[model samples]
Target: MGIITGVIGHWGWEVEDYLLDVWEAHRTPIILATSSILICVWLYLYFSEEREGLVALPRQYTVETKRTSPFQLSNPLPTTKPKVVGEKATTVGPKRIRGEIPRQTTQKESPKRDGLEIQVLVFYSSLTGKTEKAVKDLVEVSQEEINGAGTGTCRFPDAQILDLSEIDYDEYFINPPKREDGKAVDYFYLLLLPSYNIDTINDTFLEHLKETHNDFRIDSAPLSNLVGYSVFGFGDREGWPTEEDGYGFQAKEVDRWMAKLTGRKRAFPLGLGDLKMDGKARLLEWSSGLIDVLRMFAQTGVLGDGVRGSGDADESDGEYASDEEEDTETSIEGNEKPTKNKGSIDDVEDLGKMVAPSEKAPLAIDFTTYGKSKPVNIQTPQAKEMVPKTSPTYAALTKQGYSIIGSHSGVKICRWTKSALRGRGSCYKYSFYGINSHQCMESTPSLSCSNKCVFCWRHGTNPVGTIWRWQVDPPDLIFSGIKEAHYKKIKMMRGVPGVRAERFQEAMRIRHCALSLVGEPIFYPHINEFVGMLHAERISTFLVCNAQHPDQLAALKPITQLYVSIDAADKESLRRIDRPLHRDFWERFQRCLEILREKRFKQRTVFRLTLVKGFNIDEAVKGYADLVDKALPCFVEIKGVTYCGTSTSSSAGLTMANVPFYAEIQEFVEALNHELNSRGLEYGIAAEHAHSCCALLASARFKKNGKWHTRIDYDRFFDLWEERGPDGDWTPEDYMGEETPEWATWGNGGFDPRDTRVDRKGRKIEV
Candidate 1:
């Protein structure tokens, strides 16, 4: 039956059987047969496209005749004439010789906005307006030059720029005033980025846009075009590789978004711009280029046309004379947020200045202050020199997107907060391991060591060697970098689209701790001062030091958490794994252990064994247990080395085969508990990831008699043994390896396996 309909040229349903009877019996002429065959062929082709996809092909008519590019070679440059040149002139009589005749004639009026262009909407994120300054500088050079023959004043339309922090996309971009619910004014200057991202198109950007424009569909036609209109990002090549490593990736976001608009290839890929925190010159150059792009439709007459409706043509053609006179009066301002009260406050600075009078009900909030950068170091220990909460650095970091890691508002280490990761590290729906969980402290810090261990995931590396290499950066730059890191991730997630649950929150938690970046941090001479600065902020410090600097470790006060990176059990393996710069590395490590034994130290100390598969796990663990026993640390964390950073050393930590290796070590540790028990010590299981990593915190006092030694004053013991010289060096008072303490021996004849080395004859140590 369906075939019969097809033979009659009907559509929609498919039929397996043929329409026999009448058609077969009739047998037709050549013309009729040909016509019938054509009908069948046409029907089959109809369903093919529907079955395949909805991708629409270009229309047949006028599509080809249209210009191939938005900007054509013949297009005129934007014109900013008389006003740009700051010229002023009064017309003289045409027939000056006949003086009286000229006074009777009147001059023609100029337009109110003669040389203005299309309104551009620029969405920017700036730290101390470096990015904004870049834009302004571009605007300056790109403005048109004027000659003496020019008529009246030409104009530069006051461009409308919005900081993404303040505006609501739904209110302005998606829905216009008439839409009450529909049609937003399409402003093209939407550039989004000024910081860090694991990727170019991030979850936070998508989420913010989504939440801000709740009703809009990401895949829809109009919304994507408006949001995708124009884009740019700023980032560095220091961290993990992402799509936005440079101009190439940023351009791709622009291209990808543009693809949804034109259904064609995008000509411009993202342009990567890097600032190794260099000077202002590069910024000036880049800004000028961006401004040039903005002036595209400027000379095309969008603003010139808008000016035409104004009655006074002369006034419309903004004169340079008028510009100077109206400089303070007619400066146009915009409202990024769609608040109902339009004229209540003039501008952003006005909003801030109202702080004295305390503007009530509706107030303009400033997120710009948050977008500053601050460089933290362990060197240059001048207590007063460090930035304070009220300091420009603190204000700058807090105002933008940056949040300090710890509880205190004043601490300066890598300005981070929980929101740093809205996707990858954090699962937005759940609040685990993000901003609030980060803990740090202010104390005269102590601890130093070698080895940028493979397992470490810190954002920077101190790269060991010296302190005071560079002068301290002003408060704003460091904090701005810190603050912008959060929003940058948010923007990235937004571009890529979907994110795992809770990944956002988890990422935010680790914001301030970029454990691996450049150098080894322990070499900073003023580490004590730096730590003390944080302590004043009510933050507790976790000083993770390499054992290479035990002398520096000795010259200090107690911190919140101290770590000694012990990568091996003995000297030879230590060199292979830690790659220390010292001649006698093992002895240096031993000295670190000695510092841990100091009695006055009240901080919780730790020995972190970076257990790689084959490198030094066996030696390090047993030796670490020995160090743990002698060091009398508060905790011992035996973890597998994480393979990252510049080391081509072996990926022993990351390979799948290491699973059994890690498990075997755990078994070894559990078995060692027996030895710990003999010596009245204890141990626990191992872990893999941050949360998976468990530990054993040691007891303050140990047992001597069959009963117990209830109070051995751990602090007093540390104090008397660790004596300080006038020059700030440490000398152990009664600390001697030759004299074994009572606790070194268990009830049995043998000593604890961890504290006693094979070479020693029943001696040399005890925690």
Candidate 2:
């Protein structure tokens, strides 16, 4: 300022230093950032790149194909989806492996396993009383073999039929035939016979056929896949030559000892006949010509590549060969196309031949109503001279065609039932019921049954019959009353001959039915509302109670599927396979398994255990593990009881028909299913068909993350079945192929329904 004073005074102090340099150039950056003066030297350092973990790439892993049945799957499906690098050449036109493709493809079909599904059983056996009008015309030609035209089941997909007097066949070989929440059985169609004593054998059919000829592993390793058959012996002509229907000379010496135990070959027979008096019209024209040639050899397989099946016991059923075109004019210069095609009765001794009789035509009767130009209801010589003899439509039903009416053919006459086991002369195959329903859907219609199983099949006496026995007939009036009592039993059978008036009116026509027939039919308080009105018509029941009705199955109402029938593990083998009839039947059979575990439906709950070979196949694994611990059930089946009718008249009065003691009680129930999966608890023999039955199921897994696997939800058992709708809507997308239960990551991971990467006995290992 002094220098300024000197200057103007030197220019008035340069105008106050240019007005404080414009106020310190906007206040000197706020006092030089508040004191660049108070600060000095200092520096800090650090840096980063990481380039996303240095350029990644590489993954790969595979192997899939979990899909299951419904005609089996897989064309492209090995299961994968990261497929992003090459699909749009302007919309699906190019790329057969263009870019991100390492590629290798080959599996357009044939990993193999699925092509199996065909079925048909058709059995028949009657114990005189002229085989009850040929068991009402072979239950109307075995319900016209699942009907659809040309007795060959039209397109034939899964056929069936059975009725050796409503069989017990020792619990269908040991297992299959449960229900009531023990879920076992897997569809059927039987009418087979030869479970022995030929029906009236005596002493309860021979004490249930000497307990089924002293149990010889039921009869041959769970009946080795049962395959198809067509035997039809009934009796008389000194029962097929006597000493009890002279088993066609011991089945032609047990078919040369079963060709030394199955290396194949040997089958064909249709000779013997008679369930009583003219052999029920030659077994209804030989069951309408063996259900028209085993329903075309049970859906094609007339044994191709040069078809040649016929192992003669002396031929004579009309000398075999004729795939039919009005009984073949002898073609075979080239194979004529026409495709095709259960158990026991002491296993067919070289079986074969039985064709002739009702050869083809007639079989169609699925019945929603197929009166098909109706006619043959017949009987009127003045209405058969005015119906009488036991009046309820009689005069011995006036040579059939029964006219004394318009109503009342419901047929229920009753008595001759109370069995306790006694026959083993051999015949045994009976699984019919389907005329309208009753058995699993709670079969009351023929009145209530409370326990009278001396090794039952049906026709029990005492408590008397008849309850709802009507509205269900149509498979052609049970096949026009069994093709007019088997065309008056093929004019009294004898020397055979007669039948092909186009296969003897296809013995009228009927289809599958098997209410487990015999006693304790739940005890009929309208038995579970007639099993929900016979599963609303799709029909597939298999009921078999006898826990003396566990208070009528806890006052009825909860039976779409459930089965109790334990047959002894305590209370003295339940009185040797239910000889019960009250005394509080084992505290009402453990209170009907606590009312089948507090009832609920949608099918699934089973326990069946019949395994009676010499009274309880050696402690049947602590009697089926205390009936699967009071019914945690979903199946247990283990069946094996058979010796035949009245139980071969109750073991031919104890002289026992001898069958290697029912094959050592079916080889100790297959070591009680491997001692119930080595005591841990998992099972699955599921329908072996029979040597005396099996069927297990339930690995009961699915615990969640911690691990364990296959308690088999199998997409909920392939979308569950058998419902008539009481409530079981079933959803999981109805299963088949990969409909997504998805989450199956499992490859080398860990989850564990017991960690079974393979091992259903197929065994593998990775853990």
Misplaced by over 4 Å in model 2 are 1-268, 275-280, 290-596, 600-604, 608-725, 728-767
Top candidate when judged by TM-score against the true structure:
1
lDDT of each: 0.37, 0.36
lDDT of 2 at 86: 33
- Model 1 scores a TM of 0.38
The regions of model 1 sitting more than 4 angstroms off are 1-220, 225-518, 599-601, 619-621, 645-647, 650-662, 682-767
Candidate 1 lDDT over 623-703, as tens digits, reads 556666788765555555543322222232334333234455455556555556667765432112222222232343322
Model 1 vs truth, CA RMSD: 27.0
**What TM-scores do the predictions have?**
0.38, 0.21
Best by lDDT: 1
